[model samples]
Target chain A: MTPVLQIKNLQVSYYTDAGRARALDGVDLTLTAGEKLGLVGESGSGKSTMALAMMRMIKPPGRIEGGQVIVDGTDLMTLSEQTMLKARLSKIAYIPQGAMNSLNPVTRIGAQMVDAIKAHDEGSSRADIDRRCKLALESVDLSSSVFKMYAHELSGGMKQRACIAISILLKPKVIIADEPTSALDVVTQRQVMETIDRVQKQIGAAVILIGHDMGLMAQFVDKVAVMYTGRIMELSSVRDMFTDPKHPYAQALIRSLPNLENKGVFNGIPGMAPALLQLPGGCAFHPRCSKVMENCKTQRPPSTNISGGRILECHLYSEKA
Target chain B: MIKLIIRRLLFLITVIWAASTIVFFIPRISQKNPVRERFATLAISGGFSPKDLEVIIASYNTKFGLDKPLFEQYTDYLSSISRFDLGVSYNKYPRTVLELIMDSLPWTIVLLLVTTVLSFVIGNLLGAIAAWPRAPRWLRTFATPFILLQGVPPVLMGVLLLFFIGFKLKLAPLGGAYSTGVIPDWSSLTFIWDVVWHQILPGLALLLGSVGGWTLSMRGMGITIQGEDYVNFAEHKGLGGYTIFKDYYLRNALLPQATGLALALGGVVVSAIVIESQFGLPGIGRVLDAAIRSNDFLVIYGVVLFVTIAVATLMVLMEFIYPLLDPRIRNE
Candidate 1:
């Protein structure tokens, strides 16, 4: 499969009165066309930051320090600000984290969708744009009548689906859905996830599904990238990840999930994720890693590649390699 | 919506009735007789003797129906007000209060309405721009001076403007509604231009003083709205800065500001009184001022009633218009 989106050593930092917070610390990720990558991490593991930095939507105090976000063979970092704007929602669209408020409340859903299309492709006829927008709405399991509704008029599931419809309006090459199913119930969450899954397949767009729900991630994603302190600790097929995880952090994360075998018995990873402002030397997860060696506290391990295209970043994996 | 309108209108009538009744009795509490007060000011100037003044006052009271019992006069006042017959002005003899208000109403309405609207537009635009993160530095600078000017009351601004623009610079007329000797003709463009020109200074005072308030409020609202998830998502949708600012940013921010505009329009009477009197424009403010000094109780009642009705009606109109601006309010 051709890689539709590639992040090379992506680094993002937030300048503050206290100190610079390295949000995305030399992060690297790749998602091929039509593939779903579940990015599972605890809160503030740079999941949302990575999404924003890809779109270059980071507000002030937070800056994309350096990175190459190459989508469909085009290096987005090299594009001019004007071209970057056109590139967004056309080349790489972002379905925002807060689906509840991701749409303009004062405008009609059809208007919001139409405006997005207009912003990107201005030469299209009004009728054509209307048809496409309505079609996009319908594809997300919403009626074409939803086009005339306001954000407040829709249910939580409908709003999320509406956001998904908007993201697919331009048939973007890469769709980054940042926690789209949050603030939804289990049934609504499954529905929203299914809508996203169906839409991604229809558009042939790679999707980076960011969430902390291991169960939901297990069901929807073909592959999983376990993140810790702004870096992916392991990336592997979902089968190997749940069956035989490599990285100690990924193992801990998987073990932390509630299973039928561990009924009413919760197993949480010890210690907290390190602060971005002052990450521990070597591996940022060294403080919490159960399989830490003496060298693990001094030497940050490189990403070790194994058979079947799996990746693990840890002293144990590299020592074995 | 029809139910809401009817409910609001009924509430409005209750408020107006309460206000009219209070206005009727408040002036009556004073011991001063309108006829005697009117003649005293005229006599001081006319050099009239007081030999038959008491008998003349009694006869005048009888003629004006002021000799009736308090409850009887109140019922008569209410009945006459219900018919929209504001009694004749004691100060301006034989001229009805409604007639005086009508003659002066147009001037105040035009000046106040134009100034209020101009300031609202300028202020909201400048304010929204000022708060916009992507707006050019120079475009944002326009709001600061207005915010600073908000501290200077419109009445004071009028005095300063009159002194500089009128007296010192001679850019416009010193005072009054039109050029001293021009006959008022609605058909003549020059007369209208002259009237507008004469109003420039007072208009400026009102505009400069008021635009800041709108800018401040709008800027504050814009700050909140621009940071909303929808606005950020609009950017993520790759919308141009102008589209985001106008549709996503300004449209949402202007919701509360629109309501503020209604209240601003309603509250302009105090400013109108100072502005119209200072500029010597023949607006209701000046007429009301004259009536108050002469204790022309009926004319005072008439002006108060007019202002109350205008304010109450505008508030109701604002309520009906609000849901159109904010969709969330529509269902509620």
Candidate 2:
């Protein structure tokens, strides 16, 4: 089956007083139709930058330097600013980090949802738009009455679900949820994830879930990608990723989680995440890698396709080849 | 909501009572009889004093209920005021205070109310555009001149406008509500046009001075509002710039500005008095100025009470409009 979304050589930089910070450096990823990819990393690991760059929502001071985000065979980079607006939410919908303050408090939820639908499909009737909005709300397990409610009236979980309802209004080819459940309680988190999972399946759209919850990733996503600095260190099926992680950074990240065998102990990777402006030479993860070697300090690793459907980017794998 | 309005009405009555009471008693503290004051000017001007001048003053005071005990005078004043019986003017004589107010109030309301609202609209729109990132640089800078003009006091601004635009340029009439020869004709559109034409300089003075303040405050509010997540989300929803600007950006920014509008209404009469007197317009401000000069206690109390009621009523109306604009204030 053909992939629905393909991002190649994506690079984003922020020009600050100190220097240019390479937030996303030559990243590549592909998601097939109906596939779910969980993007996990530490804070400042360019996870959200990747999501923003995909939407071409990067503001001033931060620029998408170079990239080809081809969604459903259309290069989003080539579209005009006006067309780019239409492309967003219609081609690639984004569910924002909805812990708080996503919806407009002054307007009713129905107007918010209806506006998004109207923005894309201008010719649709008010009745048609209302039907679609209520339908989407219902699909997310929210009551149809929520359409008439304000953002403040809804509970936190309802607001998150309302955001999900808005994201799926057009049923875009790819959905990028940026830590959608970070503010939710564990029970509500599961409900929201299930809602996202159900909606993605219904729309047959690929989803990129960005968060630090590895357990949630294993439970929900088909594949997992571990990001370090600005690059994806490894992309693998969730089974192999948890069973046998290849990149030292990915291995340390998985090991950091509390497992049955390691009852009370956590194995956090040593050393701080270096600032993007001052990233080390060659390999970014070298200083913190348990398997650091001389070449690891001087030579950058290329992404290698190993046996089975997996991708690894590490000097250890490259050295053997 | 009904309860709220009732409470607000009761509160409005209390405020008017307190204000009118203060106006009534403060002028009396000087213990100078308005009747005597009125005739004293006449007596001094003629260079001859009537031997029974005190008798004439006493008869006038008793006629106006001013000769009663202070407490009885206050109660009589409250009762008469409640009945809307503002006594005859001492300076203009024979014309009741209410008649004087009724004659000039339309001029003040039409000019000051229109200018206040217009400045608010023009200033806010300019401010919003100035703060909007998508607006062209020149369009954004359009609000800058207004901001600079905001620091100029209305009085000075009026004088300068009157001097330059009125006297030198002759772009508008020097002062007065209308031309000298024009007969007062409410049915004639030309009469209305002449009235409006005469007000241009004073209106411009008030507009130029106050528009800048709205632009300054609105620009600040616009900047903060554009950064809100809802505005950003509106863009991400693929909304047009206009849609986001109006619904998400401008609508939210206007919440605090509406309160500013309410507070700004209180200063309307003050500016009107300054601009009207400078322009020689016969608005209620001129009436108040003449009343204070001649110590026409009834006229002073009448005009002050009228202004107090209008402002108090408007502030209460703004409170009602507030909940409509901001839903958070509703259902409380």
The most accurate candidate by TM-score is 1
- The candidate that achieves the highest lDDT relative to the unseen native structure: 2
- TM-score attained by model 1: 0.97
Error of 2 at A89 (Å): 1.2
After superposition, candidate 1 runs with Cα above 4 Å error: none
Q: What fraction of native interface contacts is shared by candidate 2?
A: 0.59
Q: DockQ for all models, in order?
A: 0.83, 0.68
Say which candidate scores most in DockQ: 1
**Per-residue CA lDDT of candidate 2, range B34-97, in tens?**
8888788888897657899889889888887788999998998899989988878977889999
Can you write out model 1's per-residue Cα lDDT over B162-235, one digit (the tens) per residue? 89988999998888989888889989999999988998898999999999999999999999998888998899
Once superposed on the true structure, which residue ranges of model 2 sit more than 4 Å away at CA? A259-266
